[model samples]
Target: MNFPSFGFGSPWVLLLLLALPLWWVARRRRPPSAIVFSRAGTLAESPRRGQWVPRLLFLVRNLAIAGLVIALARPRSGGRTEESLSDGIDIVIAFDLSSSMLAEDFQPENRLEVARAKIKQFITMRKNDRIGVVAFSGEALTQVPLTTDYPVVLAAVDNLQPGQLEDGTAIGTAIATAANRLRSAPGRSRVIVLLTDGVNNRGAIDPRTAAQAAGQFRIKVYTIGVGSRGLAPVPVGRGLFGLRYENRPVEIDDSLLTDVARMTGGRYFRATNAQALDEITREIDRLERTPARTHTYTRYTELFRWPLGAAVLALFMELGLLAWRAPLL
Candidate 1:
């Protein structure tokens, strides 16, 4: 099995290792006991025995000291697992895909392009939250389902285009579709962010009725009216060479959106530009956060016992050998 990182708990205790050399020097300098040999010739004639006892005893002494030092530097391995206390909020973004979204009044790009960029940014910020996407025009469709997998949501948002759906604003159907997705979500808080730049002109259900349904299900509905007030550049037609642009009046039903938000216990926001859209998303992010409970724990296995045991056994063996080899006095 793979083990976690290993380290010493009391590493400062390892400084005691410096004394091992000093001890060895002291042992070497000590004077050896003198032995008188009245009959040197007879002793030389007797069978010689190995003189390795003193060296063996010295090795044992050093090993005992080393083991003790290692034991002092406590060692352990592994890491703690922590559970997040903040629960994620489930969100569904209902995007407008009507032809009016192609208007270029927002600058460098059209309303749909700017909205897509801001939506991507919003998804990036809420990494822990589960998000889904719904694209609406004359009809509503679930582009992506609720999921923590952010890449799928981002991809769906990036692929949004005006001509994919029938060209009409179905604000009511969009809300109802988004609410259906959130009804079964497991998060503590469920929300739908509806973005549009036109008045509701299609679908059987009314926008207010859909908002009431969301309220009944305890889901929040934040509505955003996207576009600059007054005349904005719009693509009228394509000639022999390229597309043609003309100044047309911008039309956003902010009153209906505000009413929808009021019915669902949510807020309505007006985004005249890209920056305002970003700010509106950030505000919704702050409002959707709910408190959650979490748990955390840590486990460690100590390794000091092995070295300490070795130190004791080595010291005992050394003492026993010395006592057995000592001459009678």
Candidate 2:
């Protein structure tokens, strides 16, 4: 009752279209002709059998084209559906919301901006894994819970703005919050990405203590220190007159970050710029992998009859055209 085929099938069908030109050639007028023959009157007696030859040839040509079109369609028969393995992991981004994160040191965008960009790239590379979000500054906040929807996670990353917290950097609190949400996850591979510019200064919990909690939950934590060494410029001027502001050296405590990573059986990275941050995220992405399962269905429909019929019709047309145009030798 129904038939299925490839949408782009039978491009050769255009060849059968040659019939249009063959018909056109039939309608075209022939110039007046004078022929020298044994008997000129006999020419008229030969009958217009020549016209029938083209008609038969055109039919044969159309049949050939039709056969080619059918062949290209690649018709198949039968259908199947099944479910199989799908692999992925669980990921959470714990971003800093402290005021210092707003400092522009890596060129172009600031530290937070660089972190956001890297997180987005990392999400695209992840597969079969649920993800969550956590943002912290002087305090810690859960932005999103673990879910397979990477789009929602990416949107959360974009909304991370500075000065959300009043204290300072609470690396421990951020890690703790992220690990807590992932502690009871159904997926086995759980990971926390803690990004900050400074050491744990505001939270009651120390960075090491939080990392220990993460480890107890079997959560891997990758700590990242984002920013360059030495002083970076700050815009402290007003109007074209340019008032002027003080310059302060940029500071990052890599030791604490490294210790937190080691405590949780993870790695610590220092990103001085965008490229380093991107590479670090990619490296982590490669490290965590969880399995997933997916379902799929395939269908096919037999097409031999069409091509067989075409071959017969072309043979018949060719025979008919030859017989109809036969001349006396």
Candidate 3:
């Protein structure tokens, strides 16, 4: 829950509090008696009933004075509000799920697993942007359309597996599918982030042709090559106990990826490990930010009425007590 900000409009009025002590001392002093009593010691010898009545009246009167002083300060509560006055960017993520992505180059987790984790983090970092998801192997499939709903995008990324589609890297197809999704998106700028771990060999469209098509629509495409250098452990077949692993040479077409990025006025990134992948995503986030202007406003509500009422009520109570117990006081 958000709390309102509290403050006084006329804070200088609080200096009146300094005079309270002087008033108290003056009230405590007794004036000289007009007539002297010779047997006054006899009255002093007996205990006085309701001796605390005067003290109680003084306390009530002091409370009333304090409340009135605070009311004069013009206390109020305020709340601040902000509004954004710009459109957000539209982005589509093209994820590769080919067999090569299963390579355990990032240790403990496969390349695809680490990529999924990083992509999920990337999705959460974006604000007010509509994001879409495209899953591709031998062919491309749109897992989600452009939307501001992030949970649905994260769920689609988590559910992607190595064998969900045909067992080949369709880099060109993935780019084409992502560009199609962003062709008429609701934003001034449209973007595609395609992460692949292998060379293109299955798609009907050529990688360069797809990049040109994206360029025609003025959509920026950021390509990412994911994997470590040299060999990486991969699952080949299932054994009696569990899945079996075999080291395989890492393969990623850097030139084609770079060309695709350049043709669409974007940049190509190489992620050798998990840390590098994380850094690449952060860099992309910094590059394609939506410009926005924010306007802030503050609303204040007067709270002096409450303190004023309290002061009035305390004065009434003090007057009633003085009338009922005048002799005791």
Candidate 4:
């Protein structure tokens, strides 16, 4: 399937220009039709016994010349990435686990569920990057070590849920853990994708400090605020028909999320629904590819013109025989 050069790119096709001259030469030596032979018995046999032979040899010569012409142009059957973008990336995925994530604002599935689903997709797309996972509620903890195995990293995502830690949202702690994980990474592009619903309600570390720490390590952190501005329903008590009903108002702190992203020279994304969350994930993916590099190609080709020359000689020699080289007998 792959080749350095195809055989058809040779410049033998240019030999077709000589076809006009060859025709002129054949026509010039044609016997004059007005001349009559003295003896009918001497000119009894004609020289056109096989009309197809000379034409067939001409066809073969033309085909061979065309193949040589293509081969000369060096037609490549396939190409390779001569310059690959070596943007070795090391990433950390930090998720929120506060009780507010249980709010029904996201419908059918809560905020945590939506975040996890998108994270799984994110993991699947990063086949060459080394990724780690961190789960945070009241405190931050590394749920998985940095590795290129996406399945193991995705397994850590499955372990996320509200109340996994204590019962608070320590936004800074999660980022801090991500920073620590990437502190010594040798990758040229180090990044963190932090998803949170509420502000820093618990933990000793401040979000700003974590951002600064991540910046020191040249790590870009993209902060995503999950949830919408609305009063959502919550479960309180069972009704007569075994139906539970309740309501609560949850608010997301956009300022902290925005500051975290801006401090690390990254962008902040706000997702209000599952679809928006999917879009945010796609945007992150779009922003996460390695830089493009210029690719180069060099190849060698060996072409033989002997076959085409032989065909042309055969056709012309046969034509000469029909005209004057052979006796009419």
Candidate 5:
């Protein structure tokens, strides 16, 4: 179980605890004298109470003193408040839903599936940041608005598939759409992560022009070109034989992606496999982080009453025992 902070308010008073052992030694050295009788054997045969009663009374006196000393030290336990100073970055992830993302060169799954998994992992890591999602093919569509609700963003990314929109890469529209979403975000740092497997070939707006617009709006763009450089297997159709795979040349505009990154003062990465894509996302996550500042204050509640009560109870018991054992004066 977790406990609250506890300490003494007047710690110097606790030094009095050192006197406990000395007091015990003093009591031992000056032992009480007993009367001696000629017929001591006969006295032993007589009914007598246990010798431990007197020793218990002595122990109680010492315990009373210890409790009083601890009470004087003013032990306390209590309240703390913490405040964070750093703000979270606003991010929009633009995914290319073009048919090119269907390439199975990434691994056991296609490029889009791997991208979705990695994107979800990235979302999990960024707990404090608000994230949005944009899906693009021939045109761009904002699947999720900028929000701190990560589950919604993850759901949006998971639902993305090839051919959801027209069948052409729209890099420029995707970047422009992402930038527009972040334009009104309150965070000082706004970022867009654009992942594509094909070159821009269908959008009315040029990719460079959109990148310039993102730069003008002070939005950083991290571009990732997904797919192998050479030939990759793509699924053709399901015919008489089970699934059919055909080797197709991988086409990705690295120079254009790099220019987009440069224009927005960000970095471009080429991911040939799932591991490489994960690494790239991790690197981007590292670069975009801003340290959070925190301030903590504590309040204390004094706990002297409990020990004080114990001391009084012990002292009263000792006095009562002494009075009961005393003879009439």
Candidate 6:
């Protein structure tokens, strides 16, 4: 086991310990006898064996004095503790699960798979932040609520699929839903990360109106449009064994995305491939960082009682021994 740090509150009191040795030396010097003997060996028959008794008493007295000196120094034991001084940012990630997200322009995997991996990596880079997840296609759905549990958010991101909702993109609805989740967060900084690959084709709300509302609520929205320019292989339907793909034009509403981000005091990013997507996440991470502070303190417990008690006990033992030897003396 580990021992707590030890210290003295009044260290100057320890100077008293230096006097003990001088006192011992003075005690050891034999004083002149009150009655003189005719010769030096006249009382040789008397027992000299008990001469150590007085020395034993002196030793106990010195121990008692030493204990008292230590107690006066105010010994104590201390332990350190730390606490976070700020409530970090709160964020909600809005993911697009439209059928178009299955486009294979990102290589090795589709756009949605690459997005999930990057979102998980972003979550891992954060500390002291509460994060939530929102998945949208034809409409928006809250996959996870605002929380500090990163694992839950990661799991929700991993479980997101294109067919969960309908087959269209609702960028406006996704932003509105994510903004609502962050409006009530207690953090000073609240954010919405909207990652979509298509324009807003289905939703009751307008994208610009949602962005204005988010700005009013002091929530910033960082928009990321994911896709390669020109033609890409997009999955249309399932065949006899696997998915069928066709080359289609990649369409991303870049102008509208930029407008939405600007209205909400955020920036817009375009991810053409997996590497760009990773860099976008990193950029957002840098932009949304909240400078958090921590406070450290050390608590001390008084330990003077033990030494004071030892001092009293030693004095009592010396007194008892002296009383027991009184009759013989």
Q: Best TM-score goes to which candidate?
A: 6
User: Model 1 off-target regions past 4 Å?
Assistant: 1-82, 293-329
* Global fold similarity of model 5 (TM-score): 0.63
What lDDT is reached at residue 176 by model 6?
91
List model 2 lDDT by residue over 122-240, tens digit each. 88787767888999988899999988788998998889887566758888788889988989987777899888887677888888888898899889999889887788654444456
> Superposing every Cα of model 6 onto the true structure, what RMSD results?
7.4
Give a tens-digit lDDT track for model 3, residues 1-329. 23458888888888898889999788669673443223355347654545556677788888899999999998888855788676478899999998778888898898888999999999999988889999999999999999989999999999999888988988889999999999987577899999999899998999999999999999999999999988888778789987677998888999999999999999999999999999999999889876655456887788999988998999998999777664332
How does model 1 fare in lDDT?
Answer: 0.86
lDDT of each: 0.86, 0.76, 0.87, 0.74, 0.86, 0.87
Q: Can you write out model 4's per-residue Cα lDDT over 83-153, one digit (the tens) per residue?
A: 76644468899888876776677878877787889889978876568899988889889988789888788
In candidate 2 the C-alpha lDDT for residue 279 amounts to 89
Candidate 3 wrong stretches, greater than 4 Å: 1-83, 292-329
TM-score of each: 0.65, 0.62, 0.63, 0.60, 0.63, 0.66
lDDT for each residue of candidate 5 in 210-311, tens digit (9 for 90 to 100) = 999999989999999999878998666667886578998898999999999999999999999999999999999899875545456877788999999999
In candidate 1, which residue pairs clash?
A: none
Which is better, 3 or 5, measured by TM-score? Answer: 3
Winner on lDDT between 4 and 5 is: 5
In angstroms, the error of model 3 at 47 is: 65
Off by over 4 Å in 5: 1-83, 236-244, 291-329
Candidate 1, residues 60-110, lDDT tens digits: the string is 888888888888887777744577877578899999999889889788888
